[model samples]
Target: MIISTRRIKQWLTFLILFVLFTLLLYQVMSFFTDMFEPDSIYKEPIGDAVKVFSDYGRQTSQATFSELVRERLLWFYEIGE
Candidate 1:
């Protein structure tokens, strides 16, 4: 099998752009999460997602997405109560 140089270059460019885009998106989401209070539905989910990501990095045990969502929701309800 033979691949063209131009095709390889295009694939590399696409990979780089995809990585940069993902990083930018994560930063933007994190910024909004930090900026907003967990008072409304929109803001709360963002904050929770940030917290979950942070926790995943910090802890020895890995948390599943469902577990993180459940824990965050429980916390939110407890705060409301």
Candidate 2:
């Protein structure tokens, strides 16, 4: 039997809807996983700001501007590590 255009369109629609639904489900699962996972880096920032800079040796005033900025970001990342 020859497949009709309507039959092909129906199957294609089903496929797209299935893919979209699966993607949404996966995203939701990931969101929950990240939210509840221990040691997840998506945590609130802590520690003193000045301490973070000093810990990076920025208190010496010898670090360049770019180096200081990079170190500051590194400090933020280190909090959750």
Candidate 3:
């Protein structure tokens, strides 16, 4: 059996391009899927922290930056426990 060099090169090129295309497609799909889906970690604790800060700020007339940070850290620690 005789295989032409040109034919071998063509097959190699096709295989490489196919693999690259598949990887690119996978990355694009993953990016879109993740973009559409909301992450719970941020949605839950972060959102709750924002609300707590807002309410606390209103009640105390103003919450210091350090106080807000402390509150958020405490909230996270309590959640972990």
Model 3 stretches astray by more than 4 angstroms: 41-81
lDDT of 3 by residue, 37-66 (tens): 866756456333544335454565477867
lDDT of 1 at 30: 94
Residue 36, model 2: Cα distance from true site in angstroms: 0.4
By lDDT, highest first, what's the ranking? 2, 3, 1
Q: Rank the candidates by TM-score, best first.
A: 3, 2, 1
Cα lDDT tens digits for candidate 2, 1-81: 898999999999999999999999999999999889889566766776343234544366777777887877797799953
Error of 2 at 19 (Å): 0.5
Candidate 2 has its poorest 10 consecutive residues by lDDT at 49-58
Query: What is the TM-score of each predicted model, taking all chains together?
Result: 0.45, 0.47, 0.49
**Model 3 residue pairs with clashes:** none
Off by over 4 Å in 1: 38-81
Q: How does candidate 2 score on lDDT?
A: 0.80
Q: Could you say which candidate leads in TM-score?
A: 3
lDDT of 1 by residue, 1-81 (tens): 998999999999999999999999999999998888556655445333544346455666678767877998898899973
